[model samples]
Target chain A: MSPEAQEFLHTFVSESFYYWASVFMLLIHAGFLAYEGGASRVKNVLATMVKNLITLASVGLAFFFFGWWVYNAFPLFPMAGPILGPWTNPEASEAIKAAMPYVEGSYPWSSALGPNNADHMTGVFFFAFALFAMTTASIMSGALIERVKIGAYVFLSIILGGFTWLVAAAWGWNYFGWLFAKMGYHDFGCSGILHATAAFFTLGVLLNLGPRVGKYDPQGKPRQIMPHNLPLTMVGLLLIFIGFYAFLAACVIFLPGYEGETTIYGTPVTLASIGVSTTLALAAGLVGAYISAKADPFYTISGGLAGIISAAGGMDIYHPAVVMLIAFVGAFLMPKVAMFVERMGVDDAVGAIAVHGWCGVFGAVVVGVAAGGFPQGEGIPAINLGTQILGVVLFAGLLGFLPGYGCSWVMKRFDLLRVSPEEEVAGLDLADLGVPGYPEYATYEYVNEQLPVAQSSGSTKYAE
Target chain B: MQFSPLLAIFNPSPFQTHSEFLEVEGPFYTFAHQPGMIAFLLILCALGSIYFVYASFFIKGEQAGLKSPLALSLLLALGLGAVAERVYQQTLRQSDRPTSAVTRGVQMRSPQAPSPRLKPLALLGLVGGSAAASRRRRSSASRQRRIR
Candidate 1:
């Protein structure tokens, strides 16, 4: 093949690969829909699914216009002269040049941002990041399911997906990020940046949004809010298990000339290592979570996700056995953390805090312990416990919590955050969407009337 | 990296269809080729395939345990892996070069760079779009309250 033709072919295949990754990642949204739908009361199922779907639309568009730019622009904070400079200077590494905002074609109007012959990877890369951004929004969506106002939650999704998470990505996940350079922060698969950030954001929103009605009693004790559809929830989790490969795949760079592919931070990594580590983590996590939860299927599957998140930070470097062990620890500890948070009066509907937030922190911290001497970026300091801990605090507490709380607080002030008590009792679907999830079953009054008086109580309705 | 006889199929070196594999040295290759690692990995793969064949031919419900799901999962995984391998062979043909060099001057040729000043405008647009939706919701909420 001619040199030009070879280049073109390379571009086409590379773009196609990233695009496929983005498409596969959409399954995660489908999983979230079923997971949230099954977890919620029947009256609120459609509303939950709609909220999750709307996030894809709103966040997808918003990220295209701005989130992509944020990632490119903010990699350098106090010093950013290199941005928009010529790419051939050869002074700093390619990783640094790639991180410069709009310099390497991240501007919305840049030809590299779209389908241009001159650029093959830009569109697909942006699409992948856009999907990642949407995921951050979706994570928060599940935790505040029943009572959050649709508009308010959607607004938060726009900000979290389009702005906050992208900023965190620029700071840590980007190759030329100051944090990587100065603090030696390392997160290969974005445990802290994506999972932890989204998880903590959900926690913050839950704190401000408050628990769903009937979630707790006046005695400060928590109640078990069983999922309305366990089968759907389990199947949804299975889909997420399938979709997570795409999420991790997007975290890698598949460039033409690189031997083993590099990470977003330009560290040498391989899809093989990712595949092996994630699978081991998932298996170990399932077993661990099952054991810890006394074989509760929901937490057992969630433990699989927790294991992936926990091992994600170190997967790029960890041995398969080590990955499994780390994941096992994370999964085993996950439910206990959820219990502690519940005891603290925070009713996280889906255990997002423990699964994503705490596990993400655990993942980051353990990477520090396990891979302390690993290099973060070219010429930068190696990974250390201090830097990893700092990254956790920064991602989960500072960026995740503060923006989440402040945004929801502002919405609360405007009375835009929560549905009123009346709306909560009537069900969000009936109150907001004007339809019930199961219209046929909506008329179970006659069936209830025929039941024995003891079994006909409101609390026993779902038991049947 | 300690050898896990079970996971040797994930070793990247054996599947180097692309020329770049020869040029670039992966970090894991340093420890991956420990004396008996390759033979151990091969044995594991052979054992696994043999077990799979046996399970498909003979195992029944109670005795089958997790064999069916495991087999199905492996088939799907191998299909996806094939797709990935095809893409890698087709695309990753060139030597290592920075992405900056490849897309240089393209942005300049297209249009003016987006100013940092425009970021807030995009955010404002999101807020405005969400605000319109909220306004309708708030109006409906008030109507519900009055009726109650």
Candidate 2:
């Protein structure tokens, strides 16, 4: 084939690859829609679904306007001058230079952001990243459902999706990122950068947002608020598991002329490795959750997500067996971590903090231990335990927790963070949406009778 | 020089680069450019729809003595209006043939030329009309029940 012909073919393939990946990533939102809806009591189902849907729209726009730019601009933030990667003089590459946030086309108003014949990769790539941003925002959505104000949630989603997690990505997930270059931070699938950051952020929000009114008894003992539809929730989880394949695939960069796949950090990797490890980790997580939670359907399905996250950071290099082991341990410990969070008086409607945050930290830290002394890239530090631990602390604390807590705290002070107690008890669907997810089922007298007696008692047993 | 009235109405050239002129581009290029605009416009429409949906809820919440912030709803509506105006202006500029000032001026002066200012007003009218119709239907239904 002519060189130009080959180049065109390569560009087409690369563009189509990310395009399909973005399409598959849409399933994650679909899953979240069902998952949260099923998890919510019937009164709150539509409210739950609305929040999930709104996360996609709000985060998507925010990512296009600023999130992509932040990823490009801040790789060397808090420092000046370019940090050299394998591609010496990174600015020499047109693609890299055009993508730089300081560059004209990378900005929102740039023609490159609009329609241009010369660019095939930017739009598709931007879409993939936008989906990632939406996913990050959605991670926090489930945790604050039922009681959260939609307006407040939108504000939080924009900051987390468009700004904070991207900061973590620029610092850790990029090839020239400071964390990667100086400290050998290796989060190939963004366990630390995306999942942990969002999870910790959710934790911060939950701290300020408080728990559901009937989540606990007067003795400070936790009461189980069962999902309205266990089967639907499990099915939703399975869809998320499917979408996760695309998530991992998007992490691998397929350069047109390059021989094999590479991590975002430019380390050699293979799609086969990612596929195998992810599947094994998923299976391990299910088994672990099933055994540990004693076949509790909710925790078992949640374990599947927790498992993938646990091994995601090191899946590029870890053997399938090692992936399984890590996944199992993470899944097994998930219920315990969730219980601990509950003990602290926080109400996480879904176990997002445990699944994403704790497991993401475990995945990231395990990479330092398991993949220690591995060379990251040319001129970058080798993977080690200390840097991984530091990455977790920094990602969870500064990037994740602080903004989450600070924003939510301000919202709380203004009484804007949560719905009114009356609104909460009456259900967000009727109070906020003026519609119910299951209008027919919601009106059934028997369903109301079946609800926990504690809900109708108006007891302040759990109130602080 | 004269431009097609259809060009003014459709505004198909918003994304076409200066070099490309009227030449049809490759499939991917055409597809890429087309969807980006469609998606943007669709998102704006969806946002507008969501705002109206929530606005009704906010009013209801206030009527129920809940502290719903009407200011936030107004801010969102204003933001959407500004974005819609910018998009409309960009489309108008692109659709106006670049070589002929006379054509641009003529199109600008034409009474049929679409105005960006009408978008928000049109949106409000549509939403308000639907809301009023629903209110009437509800009141009549309640009156019939009272009579029964």
Whole-model Cα lDDT of every candidate shown, in order: 0.71, 0.74
Model 1 alpha-carbon drift over 4 Å, by segment: A79-104, A442-464, B1-148
Task: Return the clash pairs for model 2, or none.
Answer: none
**What value does the lDDT take at residue B26 in candidate 1?**
50
Model 1, DockQ value?
0.02
The TM-score of candidate 2 is: 0.70
What is the fnat score of candidate 2?
A: 0.00
Per-residue lDDT tens digits for candidate 2, residues A1-69, read 999999999988998999999999999999998999999998899989998999988998898787877
Q: What local lDDT does model 2 show for residue B119? A: 39
Error of 1 at A250 (Å): 1.5
The candidate scoring highest on DockQ is 1
TM-score (chain B only), all candidates: 0.23, 0.32
Q: Write the per-residue lDDT of candidate 2 for residues B15-66, one digit (tens) a residue.
A: 2222232132432111132354445444544553354356434332111110
